[model samples]
Target: AARLRAAGEAAVARHLQGQVGRAHRVLMETPRMGRTEQFAEVVFAADQPEGQIVEAAITGVSGSQLVAG
Candidate 1:
């Protein structure tokens, strides 16, 4: 599990870096106090203010997919 998680994270990092430029920050929000927080990982092009913000998704699992902004 740990190894799979690590590989998935690394894949996400690589995908984000390639698609959206270098990752700048990660933001999280809770829909409700008791609910799990949703996360957004933001990345931007070098010297540019605009880029893509991708929501958390598992990309390594058999049927999983990732969509970039």
Candidate 2:
């Protein structure tokens, strides 16, 4: 009986492991859907006669700086 129980437990564990693997695969393969706001970065130089406006797509943020791509 003990051996049978051990075998049953192992079978159940394998089934659960397969289920978890399938779930993980589904999550990794799924495309994320959401709305993202557009942002721009502008730089002004003190020596420049006219201020220049630089437009770029903001991909991420690092500390207080914005990463553009």
Candidate 3:
């Protein structure tokens, strides 16, 4: 219950502290067969208390099919 606009820096820090714990990154590999492309690698991180993908970076052999979540 501190105000930021009235309190400044310290209040800002407290506000951000209310956020959830840091997420974890997990790399998932999917193999491709009969294709000239290499395996697909996706970097994902768990979200808040749910522990699901909230942020991600996906890249392939050709840098194609890249996606972020």
Candidate 4:
């Protein structure tokens, strides 16, 4: 019984290792496709003193200034 249990555990370990190797291969071969964070240099108009402020529901305010992530 002990030998059978050991054999079963070894088999499971081999299967898991094979699965991990396949997953690693897939990750390496797969093309990375995703939207990257977009950033731009913002320029404020001379007439506008406050410039532009984007307010979101998750945003918080500290005193009179808006805290950005």
- Candidate 4, poorest ten consecutive residues by summed lDDT: 21-30
Residue lDDT tens for model 2, 18-41? 332121111111122111222212
Pairwise lDDT winner, candidates 1 and 4: 1
**Model 3: residues with Cα > 4 Å off, grouped in runs:** 1-6, 22-69
Tens-place lDDT per residue, model 1, 27-49, is 32222111012233322222222
Query: Against the true structure, what is each candidate's TM-score?
Result: 0.31, 0.31, 0.22, 0.31
How would you order the candidates by lDDT, starting with the best? 1, 3, 2, 4
Give stretches of model 2 more than 4 Å off.
23-69
The numbered model that scores best in lDDT is 1
The TM-score of predicted model 4 comes to 0.31
Pairs of residues clashing in candidate 3? none
Instruction: Quote the lDDT for 34 in model 4.
Output: 13
Better of 2 and 3 by lDDT: 3
Task: Please provide, for model 4 over 1-69, each residue's C-alpha lDDT reduced to its tens digit, 9 standing for 90 to 100.
Answer: 999998987775554333321211111111221111222112212222232333222122233222222
In candidate 2, the residue pairs with backbone N, CA or C atoms under 3 Å apart (3 or more residues apart, or in different chains) clash, namely: none
